[model samples]
Target chain A: MQTVAHAVIAAAGLGSRLGLGRPKCLVEVAGKPILEYQFDLLAQVPDVRLVVGYMEHEVIDTAFQLRRDITIVRNPAFRTTTTQQSYWLGGLHIEEPCLYLDGDIIFERRTFQTFLSCAEANAPLIGITEAKTEQAVFVAAEPDPRTGFLAVTGFSRTDRSLWEWANIACLPAGLLKENGGDVFTRLSRHLPLRAQPVECFEVDTEADLELAKAYVTRLHGAGTQVAAA
Target chain B: MKPNTAFCFDLDGTVTRREVLPIIAAELGLAEEIGFLTQMTIKGQIPFEMSFRLRCRLLAEIDVATVAKIVEQVPVDPAIAAFLGEHREQCFLVTGNLDVWIARLAARLGCRVFSSTAVVRSDGRLGPLTSVLRKSTPIRELRGQYDRVVVIGEGQNDMPMFEEADIGVAYGGVHAPAREVIENSEYVVAKGETLCRLLLTL
Candidate 1:
């Protein structure tokens, strides 16, 4: 198993659905920008890339202040594309296994680290969490008889399952297409991928924002005494 | 294997951490005055050749040695300097700046450099500009020697360099690149480390 060092964060979306008038990564939860949290966890990652589009300056300014060494790839067509496109554009031509995640969500620190650990050993892995968001593409996964870890069987919006696509994965380069249904749709081609569980709060609506705030507040209040990611 | 690629860098803001001229102006308390014109030149508000002559005249009030001293002291982008040090043979510094002003700085990287030349009067004062460097001249000159040429710059003056290269990268390490330069480039990179990484893997 190869070690993982590269990571791409799709922070280009307009966040029109969230009605924040800003990119989701800038959304402040518990008085801190979500990007700050993402950077704090990604401090160990050597090569981190961001695809910026909507209010790119704001994102770039905030990103540079966090880490001066990060690589920024622009998504000029961000208005028309999805996060999948941002993922492809951000990770352009860098041929290696890269950890991919959306900027609209918050993950438990310990669990996210565990997922990265699993990703290093598993290579191509899917991250799933218990269904908790308002709108989600549910994931159907089953235990791989050999490894005993759940493997992502399929993703469907209509299907109900205990698992939901966390929109996080460690994948080989060139697997993503510039125009794809979504991250899961592209990952679906390589089925039965190993699935690792993580605790995440994905912000899509006003309600989800409240949930994320409370989640972070709880984490801060409890410290490491709480459940692991 | 990647093709033989020549990396061309604009000296002022792209390679240095700050615009070179302003630092020289600061010595004579003309930083703000020269800084304004530098910004205008970068945005294409002033024709590069005309502005170069005018700035040269304004900065000529200072002795030639002082000008060189100021430019040499300007901080460089550490990551980019390291990249140039490692690939000096393939790396080239292309600048619209005068050669005399940047010679010491260029020697530090140990790379081939192209710049506008100027004369020095017998009294040790700077003379008039001998010629102004056209941004794309080096790209054309290096085309036969290398399989590909990649240009990096941050101002409107770099538009031609962007057009001539196989790939152009708009750099924004010091400040946001000119909008047109960003549009002309195949990629827009914000951090020096990112720019160096892209150079390594591109």
Candidate 2:
């Protein structure tokens, strides 16, 4: 399987709805901060650029503690701009194909492994899951007639039948460079989007955090049971 | 001077609250040496052209990618954004820093930049300095076009510009303007907001 060596994590949002008084990535989940798990999984990726705002100093401190060579980009106008802008800013330093992850996401390492191991190495791949939530980015997909692989038709905010976007994707450097004001919207139209099934969720509110914790705990318990059996 | 004046700003201390070269040097673990050289140059103990070339030579082996990442994090004065927004076309970033290092920053500010140029090697590392900027050149160039050229700076490097400009403001927002810069200027402003108000009256 082909492996990418760069990743861009957009963690610049204020996370006001999370009500954490700090950036959501710093919020502890299970035993460690949410971004810690992400760093552990992405340790092999040599270049990791973290776009930070809101509590930038704290985030940079945490990120440096996790990895000494991590590159940090600050979006000073983060209060006025969207996550897309932060993504663009962080992507500036990355020159190779990269995995783009949202800061508020919590998922098993296998989810990323699955996406990386998938056969769609050349094209952009967006992770999608059967799991649904009130605040999920819905992705429309159809089975490819030739290869039986699921091909992404479009993305929407209010599509009930569509699977939820898992907030993780492997994007080509060219696509990242071409990103403008509305990145995701433009990307869906420009790239030949492929879908990878992964078990993942985004954390936005207190209830979402609880959901993430419970999901992780359940996965851990299931692993323990299998080990004992 | 009327509203049709050209505004030239010194990048390191005047426009940005921090000295960019020392920050870059500190990131590369050469802060003490570079910092001393920078202070000596600014204090007029060493000539700028000589200090600048020596600094670039020390930075020659550093990868352009690493420098770009570090430069991206260098903080700019917050009030300068609004000030530039109000007078976009007239604002110019005049810095002695290499073009290879400050390109992204200048592009982000969306202003014309008069900066030193560095030779980028085939391997993507910074090479020798091709051009050393003299601030007076840009100030004199602006004078030909505008009725009044208002220059704001805080370093001895800006002394030539202060002599060439029609109106000079010694800015001490980050630290006190150098003695020679302060002596040559007509007004001195220490705060960003106050500087903006002073510019309005110009």
Candidate 3:
């Protein structure tokens, strides 16, 4: 049986790049809140905990209005921290495999569905999108010609290069618990873990939001519902 | 903070399970005018106040007695009624609606009502109120007075007040809050009874 997993959403950061006075999660792309779109999909699966920091009231109000069953945790250090810290704050009380989502990104529902399906199947999958050179943390991958297994070398931090931005991930509880607070402090240490990739979207900047809006317009034009990866 | 406390609620989705404005307008046979404004509000093309004023003018052709009759057809949540009745002294209704039939509603719920109104002349034609209270004003005032204030609502208009409250609850009905509010609220509840239950428990 695939036990229902809990989801931890890191919505602590004020996405300044988006230039929307409020948190990025509050920004509306389509008619729905981006965070709700994330929660709505996760709500269908099972248990979820939303970790909120800046603009916590707005996020909790909406989530609670959507479904009172959602557990909300506060992160006081959101302003001075990275997403890794936000993840750790929510990760502290979690058990079983949990899904972690970046509150800003919006993607197709199938992307998240695939992540859940993979998690259910015991496959650790990481959602990935092509990032430009400027937007990438370049890590070299050796695609084995025979076995087709891509072996990752050491991590190389890049600047201004578009690469895969991992929007969502199905992480086992052990990954969170074992790492503890150091998870954000030590993500650079784990180069091999960035193996599997899925459809990923980034909403880090105003340009990204406009791109997403246009993307959504096109997707809806083709009669598709926007889902998160 | 001297336990600053005030009960602020939205009329349509928060107290009732649906949007009462459209229902009331429809009942008064001004469905077309009200419906158009409502559609515009939902589409984010116009602020709620503009839409509300236009609807009230359309319904103004009808008598207050007819509005009361229509209000009778509107369903209110029993638990919400009980909550308001019990907390009448502390509760205050803050809505974007004109006071077409709010007098009866105020008497029934036994809570103070704060709404915009279209003034009726001696001849029974209506004119606008001195000033309309935007959704956040009540919350801002309540927050200033009380150490604690909570606003329960379900819609885009509720977003500003949702930001002002110490505890903000998004009620799911005709429209849910923007996804951002949901993610940030202290609690999110669907029905009025469930919301009342949670409030009492807290």
Candidate 4:
């Protein structure tokens, strides 16, 4: 069982790029909202918070139906803020290690479970994936001598790398700053963080949504193989 | 420096387990009629102040002693009651509920009350509306006394305080907050124990 007590989903973005005129978490991938998959995976986390702003009632209503126990932290300033700020607000007053992630993600169950195990084992861990988004923040990494597992060295949008940030991390609440520009930018300040492979798909744009559909289809087709390799 | 924060709470459906108005209406067998209006007001179809005025008029015929007796029995979350009791000096009940109807409930909760004031008539029934609280007045006053004022509520009427206070927490322990309240709030908490835990830490 994961020891982390809190999980916060930063779902307050306008997702203007997707142009659905709704919160991205409400955008259905196959037949369900992106939040359902996240809720299913977060069964063990005792405290869950969704930072909602853009079209929040839809998210809150859906949350009431899907998972009612989780807390709903509102970020009314979605128009002017980024995910970093939303995560900060959601994680506010949370003193323990928190599992923080983007709302628009579909992570393979087994891979995500492994990532959770690693999260508890490592302090201030970052989730990485196989460099596969449309506008990927490529992660530069090298093998850790102790475990031979990849550890993030640096992050860049222009630089090419084998792995990218999966928009997930298990971090102390104090590490997240109010003015933290982007989640990645804030994480960049404390570099050389431990990295663990978590097979996931992020839906950001119209094109990426199609790729996510394929990713979900792959997950359905093969239970174990479609996940972290 | 962390400011001396004051925790101001709304009464109906927030501290009290149910909406006090509808419960009072039940005394006169207008529960269904007033309950429908309450639901409508919560959904933002009927305006809160207008609905409140109309409900108060409908309920004005009931004896003030009887209304007080009914509200005295309304269930409250013990965890929240304990939280208020522990911080009575820094806590307040800022409600749009009439003082005559909910004053006893507020006193029981150990909160310095800021509610719409009213008086008993010659016949022992509540008189015409004396004042309808704007809800923001007390929050504005508290801001002068404290570095940060935190507002906790779950209704449409609570939006003014949410906007005025330094920090707004939409409490959904009893019911999901009005959409406008959530929009104005900086944080929305779902459970009373969790809310208390958060308040203790903050």
What are the clash counts of all predictions, listed in order? Answer: 1, 0, 37, 0
Candidate models: Cα lDDT each: 0.85, 0.77, 0.66, 0.84
Clashing pairs in 1: A111-A229
- lDDT of candidate 3 at residue B123, scale 0 to 100: 69
Using all chains and alpha carbons, the TM-scores for the candidates as numbered come to 0.88, 0.54, 0.51, 0.87
- Write model 1 residue lDDT over A69-106, tens digit each, in one string: 78777888899988899999877778888999998888
Q: Determine the iRMS, in angstroms, of model 4.
A: 2.0
Once superposed on the true structure, which residue ranges of model 4 sit more than 4 Å away at CA? A120-122, A146-149, A223-229, B1-3, B30-61, B121-124, B127-131, B173-175
DockQ for the candidates, in order: 0.53, 0.03, 0.05, 0.50
Lowest summed-lDDT stretch of 10 residues in model 1 chain B?
B182-191
- After the best TM-score superposition of candidate 1, give how far the Cα of residue B161 lies from its true spot, in angstroms: 3.1
Candidate 4 CAPRI-style tier: medium
- Residue B72 displacement in candidate 1 (angstroms): 3.5
lDDT of 2 by residue, A1-229 (tens): 7777767788988888889899988888777788887887777776676778788767866876776556555676789887777777666534566788888887677656767777344678877886566677677787887655687787777776558777777877656542255456766875457778877768898888898788777877777311001
lDDT of 3 at A114: 57
- Candidate 2 Cα errors over 4 Å, as ranges: A119-121, A177-182, A224-229, B1-202
Model 2, B10-65: lDDT tens digits are: 99988888989999999999998898898888677888899999998888889987
Model 3, B1-202: lDDT tens digits are: 1224677888877776667777886666667877888889889899777776666667766776667666656678888889889877678888776675666776777898777765766665555565666777777776666678877777777777788787777666445556656755665556566567555534
Best of the two (2, 3) by lDDT? 2
Q: How much does each candidate deviate from the true structure in C-alpha RMSD?
A: 3.1, 16.0, 11.0, 3.5
Which residue pairs come into collision in candidate 4? none
* Candidate No. with top lDDT: 1
**Model 4, range A1-229, lDDT digits (tens) per residue?**
4488789999988898899999899998778899988988988887888989888888888986887677888777789988898889888887788999999988888888888887652468899999988899999988898755677889999998899999999997688888568888888888878888888889899988999888887777766443222
